[model samples]
Target: MARVLIAPADTRLSNLRYGKSYNVLNNMTADDVTIDALVGEEETAVEAQNVHVRELGTQNRLQYYGRSFRTAAREIRAGSVDIYHHMNLSYRWFNPVLLAGIAADTPTVLGPCQTGHAIMAEEFNNMLSQAVGYELPLPVSNAVYYPMNAVRDVTIDPVRMSLFRRTLEAADRITVVHEEAREAYARHVDESKIDVIPLGVDAELFEFTERQDTQTLVAIGRLEQRKGYDVLLDALANVVEAFPNVHLDVFGEGPEEQALREQAASLGVADNVTFHGYVDQSVVRDHLARARAFVHPSRSESFSLVRLEAMAVGCPVVVTETAGAHEMVRDGKEGFVVPTEAAEPIADALLELLSDFELTRAMGARARERVERNYDWRAIGQQYVDLYRSLL
Candidate 1:
């Protein structure tokens, strides 16, 4: 068996979304270090080797996933682990300091966990290069903070870049959860070393549960411009005009909640759209089980675990073509994918499914089948294990 060390920017052992990366990695294999409790206690125990980081310094905070990498690396090295797997480094400040040691000795693979192809957009790529150098021109915007990019510069400073550059140049392999991201990373780094590995979810946790509810339309994810909740509300305005019983429920929280709420009221759909705010992961299944359908109108996404979760519960998903989830959903077969920016098409797609309950059920069944075969946690976990072993 190959021994691997998993390092996530977040407490992979406990985090609901990103933690899944670690869960898939360590489930049937050996994991050296899993910091910040990204996985729950029950999950950590199931894994063969589990280590936790208790420090809540400025580094390990929600925004500072990169800082934990060094601490994770230090511990992994101490234990003589074979491979270092870093999740979501491209998303935020992944300090170079921790990577320096790994690059120097062990074979390492950094998983680009966000939407894969999103980095290929010119605007996004330019912005990302700036972000890497700590000179991001765009203002920070994420959940729970005024300036989301505030820590970017500080975290990816000169000392950090030195470490990261060395690691990137020395790493034996570079991995992306999404295939598109692997291609994008190739443009910046060595293409020969890049590998595409799809991220996995615990399908059993979000398995389909038949429900009689028909009026509920659920949307879950960060409340940000990228998520296109505003467009969803605008589309809902048109949807409810023809179908009054349609009630849209939004899950998750972000910096754009107020703006989205105001848009909902402006569109005269406030009463029809309920913002669920940020809810516990345990209750997410309840919402998924009861919803009539799942709608994701994100303008951008590397990969959408929420969409995967919704589909796992047999909800017919209506997402935008611009989102990476489009790759996952087989249009007309599993779900629908429309233009990213327009509200008219979004509303049309929702109404189309609403008008035909039988069609929705058929598509939803297909959606569940797709995930069951390809995106389920155990199946996906084995793929990751194979990749880790191959590198060794």
Candidate 2:
């Protein structure tokens, strides 16, 4: 019976509501193998035997200390955990954990959720500066650029870069979620030690449902500039002239929500676009079941579960070529990918899908087939299990 320590970024393991990513670890546990999580304080009792919820004061941020890290490492060592998987960004506060894991001779695995090398390296610098008030050399290259209110300038911080590399150095292996991420890691690390395991979805949950024939399109993502809602709106301004019946449902909430709403009005397509802000996950599924197609125009993404979810439910997808969604969605076979931020091209792609019902159905069916064949959760979970075991 192998024991594994799964460390997540936040209080997700307890909240099944947004714990979709837990599929990899949660379902892979066996009767003999004990699964434990290092989670936040608010999490309720986890079903695993070795749950360690970090107790934080009113500040709500768990302060990491060498003593505490060593204590936890001692417990895991006593339990004889076969593997330690780091799922969180490489924060300097937890640097002691990396040291302790090494001291205890536990093989560590870093789960590169996106473009690991560039993103983690940048995040490493930030955590290091905040925790130590000094700059250090970054060892990895895990940088990700998406337009968010937090980092609007489109640059990864150097401090984050340092911390990310330190963490990468501690890991025995790294797992990338997509080909783009793998390529990004290859630029910094030995390609032999990095592996690609794309995110999987519950094919059953996103199974096909009866949908309306109305010329309605849906897009799901956080309401941020990187998501390209503004680009979609610009494209839609021309689309409505050709098909007045066309409508759009944008599903998400973020700092740019009001601005995007204003942009839609400015484009004179406000009436045609519906803002269904951040619906509950289940409700979002219900909404997806009713849409004719799913549209994603993000400038960048590691991989989009939204696309898999829509495809699992037999909805054809239209996305931009620049996103990681390009890797999973085949052009013209399961979905269509167009040029990024090119309003005319997007409008043309959308129109092409809307004008041909037979093509739409075929695309939707092919999308579902692709997901079932390659991205089911059980298959993905076993892959992680095998990866974990190889290091042991």
Top-scoring candidate (TM-score): 2
Question: Looking at model 2, which ten-residue stretch has the lowest summed lDDT?
Answer: 140-149
lDDT: which candidate is best? 2
Enumerate clash totals for all models, in the order shown: 15, 23
In candidate 1, where is summed lDDT lowest over 10 consecutive residues?
Answer: 32-41
lDDT of 2 by residue, 1-392 (tens): 67677654343344343344455654464544555555444443433343334432221234433333454567665866677776644332235577544534777777745752223334444445445535544442123223332583444455555556666667778788778777776665677888887777877766776446769898998787677888899989888999888899988886578999899888889999999887787877877787778989877665677788888888888888763666798999987988877788888888888888888888888988899888887687677777877876
Q: Write the per-residue lDDT of candidate 1 for residues 1-392, one digit (tens) a residue.
A: 34455555333244465466455544543353332332212333335344333433442233345455555656665866676666566543354544455446666767644533332222443345443545333343122132424564666456555555555556677666666666555655688887766666677777787645487899988776677888888899899989998998898886689988888888888899888888887677888788778899888776777788888889888998753555688888878888888999888888888888888888888988988887777766556566667777
